[model samples]
Target: MSSKTVKLLLVGIGGYGHFYIDGIEALADQVELVAIVDPFPAQALDWPTLQAQDIPCFDTLDAFLATGITVDLAVLASPISFHADQSCALMEAGVHVLCEKPIAATIPEVERMREVRDSTGKFLEIGYQWSFSEAVQNLKTDILSGHYGMAQCLSTHVAWPRTSAYYARNSWAGKIHNAQGAPVYDSPVANATAHFLHNMLFVLGETQQSSALPRKIRAECYRVNPIENYDTACLEVETEKGDRILFYTTHAADANDGPSFLYRFEGAEIRYEIGGDIVAYLADGSIKNYGNPEGTHMRKLDVCVAKVLDADGATTPICSIEAASSHTYCVNALQQIPVYTVDPAYLQVKEIKPGEQLTFIPNMGVHLREAFEQQKLFSEMNFPWATPMGAAVVVCPIHS
Candidate 1:
C-alpha cells in the first residue's frame, strides 16, 4: 500500500471538513483527493480550487460509492446522526474511515460500526484530536506503565461560550435528534467540548486504542438557551474499574475558558490548563511536563493517513470505535436522564456579536470551576437551579 499514493474520499467539507482540506495540503505528496461527498459542496471554502483541479463532488456517500472509484480512506466530517451509517457503508465498500468524534449517539450504531470494521478488517479511527496528539499518547503510556500508580479520579472543566449563530450554523448543532428521528444528542459534551470528556476516558483506557467502560452516570443536565439539548452538563461517571470521572462543560458559560483537567493518581497528580502544558506533580517533588495537546489538532489526519497507507512505523493504533464508544455510552445515558430548564432568575441573554445573541448563566464559569476543583457536580454544590438526576446506568455487553 505504501508503494502508491493513497486515495482519499472526503465526506462533508461544509464545516469541520475544512480541517481535512487543510491537512491534505500538508500531506499533498502522500495522498490523492479522489472525490468529495457533501450535500452542499460549493459551500466549502475550497470548492472553487477543488473544482478547477477536476475533483468531482457527489451529493451523498452512496453516489460516490456507486461511481466505483476506489478510495483508501474516507474522512467523515458529517453530522452525528450520519456517522455510523456512513462509516459502515464506507468500510463495507473496502475503505478505511477517520470519523469525527463521539462515534455515534446510540450504542447500537457504535456496535454496528465496530462489527463492520472488524469484519472488513479496516481501521475506523475516531478523530478525537487530543487522542491523536503526542501529549495524550504520552500520558496514556505513563498510566499504563503504572508510573502514576492507580488512577484515583479524573476531572475536566470546559467553558466555551457559543452564541445563537453557532447553533444556527447547522441543522444538527444543538439538536437532540435529527429531522429523521435518528439520535443526534448534540450538546456541549457530545459535540463542541467532547475532546475533554473523551480525554478523561481515553487516558484511563486499558489499551492505547480503548477507553474505560463507564458503568454508571450521575448527572445534572441544564440549559439556559432554548436549544433542544442541554448546553451545560455535569457528569460523574463510574468506570468498570470503579474509578471516578467527573466532566463539566457549558456553552452557556459567561466566559471563554478553553479546557482544564486534573487527573489524580496515587503517585502523582496530572494537570493541564488551557494555554499551558500537561504537567504531572509527583510525590517525589519532581515535575514532568507533556507538551500541550491543542497544537496537534491536524495530526489526526496524519495519524489516520499513516495507518491507511501502512507506512513504515506508522501502523499506529489510533482511537478505535470501541474506545470512542465509552463517550457515546455516557452520552446516551445522559439522554435518559432529564434536563432541567434553567429558571429565568439565574439566566441572562446577551448579544455578544451583532446577529449573534447568546443565553448564558451569569458567572457560570466560576460556579463550575468551583465544582471541578472539588470534583463535584453542580447539584452537589447546591446550585439552586440545578436538579439532580438519578444514576443513569448503561449496559455494555461487549465490555461488561
Candidate 2:
C-alpha cells in the first residue's frame, strides 16, 4: 500500500463496466482512472463515456500490460470465460483485482486463479455485491448465531423475461463457449441471477466457507430461445449436511418481477425479493421486514478501494474469490449437463414487435412461487411441462 492515491484500470467497458466506472468516480478522491482495456472498445455502448472522460483505451489486455503501466487495482467486467486468465495475468503483474461473479466458468479455472493469487500474494475479490449488504450480513450473523435455528432448506425463483435483443446484445450473451472455444456458460444462473445463487451459498455457510458446497446437483434446464444455454432452469442441490437447495429462474417470462428467494430454517424464514424487499418470518409468527434500499453495488466498490488503500488491511471485502468458489463449482457442474428444450406444445410465445417476442410458460410466476413456498422442486409439483432432473444430476466435489 502507498500513501499516494491508487491507480485503477477498468477492463471490459461494456454493460457491467458502467457500474464500475460510476463506482470509481464516486470514490475519485482515493483512486485515479489510469487506463481501460476493452477488446472491442469501439463496440462498447459506454465507449463514448470513456472517451469523454479522456481515459486512454487499449484493444486488448496484453496491449495495456505491454505499456509497462503500473495500476494498483484492476476491476474486471469482462465476459465470464475471460475472467481467470485476465485476473491471474493482472495479479501476476502485481495488480490486485475485483472481478465480476460466477468468478470463472469452471472449478479448475477458479482453482488456477487461487493458485496464482497465492503465489503472487495479491488480493482478489469477486463482485458478489449481495454479500456486502448490511441487512443480508445481519441475516448471516443471525443464522450463524443459531437465532435461525437449524436450516432446513433454501429456494430461489427469478422470472424476468428477455427478448431477442437481450440475447443479441453480445456474442456471449447466451453462449456456452466464446469464439475462442473458452467456456462462457452465460446462462441465467451463471450470469444474470448469479448473485442470488451466491447469496444462498453465502447465507448457508460462513464467509470462511463462503458457500455450502454442493455434493450433487440435479437440474432441468430448458432453452426457449435459440441459444446454446438454457433460458429457464430449475435446480436442486443436496449439500453435505443433506439439506436441499432449490432454484428456479428464467429469462423467458413476462416481466422483471423476480429472483425472489426463501431460506427456511427450523426456527425462522428469511425471504428476499430481488430489487424489491426482504423479510424474515419468525418462529413465533412475527414479521420482520428488512427493507431493500439500493447502492450496495457501489458500496462494494468503495469497500474494495478502502481495502486497497489500507496498509494494515483493516477493511476487508465481503466477497472474495475463495468465498465464491462454491458458486463457480456449482455453475461448472450444471454446465456439464446438457440442457433440454421445453416442448413447443407447452410454450406460449407472443411477438411484441419486429425481432422481439415474449416467450413464457403460462402461470410461471404462480408455479414458481408455489414451489418456493413449499420448498419443493418444480418437477415435484407435477406440472405437465416440468421436466424431471433426476437423470441430469451432476455430482460435484467440495472445494476443499
Candidate 3:
C-alpha cells in the first residue's frame, strides 16, 4: 500500500521557515511541500528551486489559500505578533496548523486561537521543537518509567549575547509593541529563553498535566541595553507538584558562551551541555554521554512531523496543542512581567567609553535583512541573531 502524502503550505520563509523546509526534506517520503508564502519578495530567492520541484510560491497567505493548493497542513513561521491571526486564519480555512512558538502574544489571543481551532476541528500544534530532542525523549521515557521516582528540581541557563547592532537592524527589533499590546512582540523569554523553559516542561512531563500549574513565580529582569526590553532574567517557579524550576537567560554575554539545559531528580542528574552533548549520572556511579555534535535544531521538527504522521486519533507527544500551550503560557507570562524598563532616548544614542572594545549588535533588523538576502537562512542559522557580539552590562544603579 502506498503511504498518504500530507501536503504542506509554509508561511514566512525567513528564519524558522528554513527549519521547516529542512524538516520537510527529512520526511519527504511522508510529506510534501506544496506551497509557500512570504511577504518580502526578495526573501523568496529559493522559490524557483521549490517551484521546479513542484512547489508553488506566493507573496501573501490569502493568495496561497485561494490557489486551491490542497494542502493538509499549514506551517506558520511569521513573527510573534502574527501567530494568533495567521493560525486562526489557516485553521478557519480548514487547514491544520503547526505554528512557531509563543503561541500568541497574550493569553486572550491564545484562548481565541483555541476556540477557533476547536470550532473548526482543525488541529493546532504550536512548535516547541525542543521537545523532540533525543536526550529529551530519553529523559521523558525515564521519568515516565519511574526510574527517577519523582522529579524534584529542574534548572536551566540560556545565557547568550546580543550586540547593539542586533537591536538597531530593524524598526521592531526590540520594541514593546507592534502596534499591538502583545508583550511578546520583542522580548527575551518569548523569543529566546522559551526553548529552555519548554524543554524543562517536556522533560518533566508537565506539558499535558494540568495538576502542575506554576503556583509561585518570582523573577528579576535586567535591561542593560537602551532598548525597551529586558536583556537578562532569572526566575524561580514552584509548581503545584512541588517541582521547582530555575531559569536564567541573557541577551548580553560573551560570544563563545553557548546555551545549556540541566535537570536534577532525586538520585539522578541529566545535563544537555553546550554544543549538543547530553551527559547523565545515576546514583550508582553510572555516567553516560549522548553526543550529537553535528545535529541541527531542524531535526526536532522532523521528529515531530514523523510522530504526528504515525500517531492515531490523539495528538502525538511532540505535536500536541496542549503541550505546546503549556510552554506558551509560561513564556508569555515571563515576557508579560514588567520586570525592567529602559529609556527610549538611551536606545537612540550610541554609548561609548574609552578602552572599551567595539562589539556588533545582533539587531533583528539586521537578521531580517540577512534573511531577506539569504532565502535559506533558518531559525538555527549561526547568524548574529543568536550570537550577539556585545557585553550586556546592567546600568541601573538605583533600586526601588
Candidate 4:
C-alpha cells in the first residue's frame, strides 16, 4: 500500500497509446505523467488532452533526451521497429521502459535492447496487455497448479476486417519496414494480432519446463491487400519444450468477429471464445465457467506502475523482456519469409467509393478454423497458393 508516485514519460501518444493515457489517468494517485513525446503529435486524436493539461511535448526522443529531463519509467507506445533504439536510449539515461508488443521488429534489435537493460540494470517490459488480465492470470495459475495438467496444444483464430482508412492512419500503417526511413515494421501477426500470439507464449511459458520459445515453424503468409506486409497468415510452431501452437489470423476477413483460443491440456480442455467466456471441461465430467473481465488496455501500465513504485525485483512486469524474446523471434522468423500476394482470382474487391475499396479474402473463415483444429498449415489444407509441409518456407532463426 505504498503511495509513492513514479514519474512517468509517455512516448508515442497516438493510436494505441491512448490506452496508456487512460490507464495512467485511472491510476493518477500512483503515477505522475511527466511528459509526452511523438514525432507527429498533431496526428493523435488525444493530442488535445495533452494540450489541455499544459504538459511539455517534444517531437522526437532526441529532443526529449536533450532536455536532460528524466523519469522513473518511460512507456514506449511507439512503433515496433523503433522499440529497440528508443528503449535502449531511455534505459541508458537511467529510465526503465515498458515497450509496446512484438518487442522489436527483429531478433538483433531485441538482443541489443536486452544488452542495454542488463548493462544499465534498468527494467524492460513488453506491452502484451492480456498477460495482465485477471482471467488470464487465473488460467496461468490453474495451469501451474496442475488443474489442466500438461498442455498439449494451443490454437487461436482471429479475423478482423480493416478498411483502407485504417491503413491510411499513418505512413507506416501496413508496411513490412517503414518506408519513411525509420524502422517501423508493421505486419498483422507482429502488430495487430500480436496479443493473440504473445498471449500463447506467455501462458505456456508460465509452466516450468517450457521456456516458451518457438523451436521450429512452418507458415503460410499471404497478402490480400496491396500493403507491403501480409494481411493473412497461418502458422504452426513447435516450442522448445515440445509444445505446439497453431495460429490462424488475419485483418482481411469479412467481419470483426474477435479472437478465440482453444487450449487442450492432458487433464482438461479450456475454450476462450468471443465475448469473454472461459469454459473448461475437466476429466471428472464436470464443467467450469469463468467470465473473463474486460480489462482496460492500460491495465498493464497499472501493473508497471505498481512494480516501479514498490521497487520489487521479485515481482516482474506482466510481460518482461526475457519472456517476450520468443514472441519477438516469431515475428523475426515470419519477416524472413517472403509474403506471397494472394491470387487475384481469390480476391473480391468491393468498391467502397470512387477511389477506395476493401480487399476481401474469400472463404478465409472456414479454412482458418480447419488449420487450427487440425493443427495444419494453410498450405496443407490445399489452398491454391499454399505450399505443402516439406515445401513450406522455413525462415525461423532457431529452426534454420
The number of the candidate with the highest TM-score is 1
Report the C-alpha lDDT of model 1 over 1-400, residue by residue, as the tens digit: 5667889999888788887898998899999999999998788898888889999899988888889999988999999999999999998998888999878888899989978988988788889999888999998999999999998999999999998988888877789988888889999989999989899999999998789988888787887888899999888888999999999899987678759989999999999989899999999999999999988888989888877677453434578875798888888788877788888888888987788888888888898899999877787788777765533444434454
State each model's CA lDDT, in order: 0.86, 0.81, 0.62, 0.79
* lDDT per residue (tens digit) for residues 265-369 in model 4: 998888887777778899899987766735445677777777787776624546677678887788777777777877788778777777767787776776677
Kindly give the number of clashing pairs for every candidate.
Answer: 0, 1, 12, 0
Candidate 2 residue runs with Cα over 4 Å from true position: 1-3, 207-209, 285-294, 314-317, 388-391
What C-alpha lDDT does candidate 4 achieve relative to the native structure? Answer: 0.79
Q: Model 1 Cα displacement at 30 (Å)?
A: 0.8
58-154 in candidate 3: lDDT tens per residue?
Answer: 8778888787768777888888888888899888997878888767766678788879988987777766655655665665667777776778677
- Point out where model 1 deviates above 4 Å: 1-3, 311-316, 388-400
Per-residue lDDT of candidate 2, residues 184-260 (tens digit): 88888898988877777788885543677788888877788888888887888887767788888888777676777
Candidate 3, poorest ten consecutive residues by summed lDDT: 391-400
TM-score of each: 0.95, 0.93, 0.76, 0.92
Q: Per-residue error at 122 for model 1, in Å? A: 1.0
Instruction: In angstroms, give how far residue 337 of model 3 lies from its true place.
Output: 4.2
Residue 328 Cα positional deviation in candidate 3, in Å, after optimal superposition: 3.1
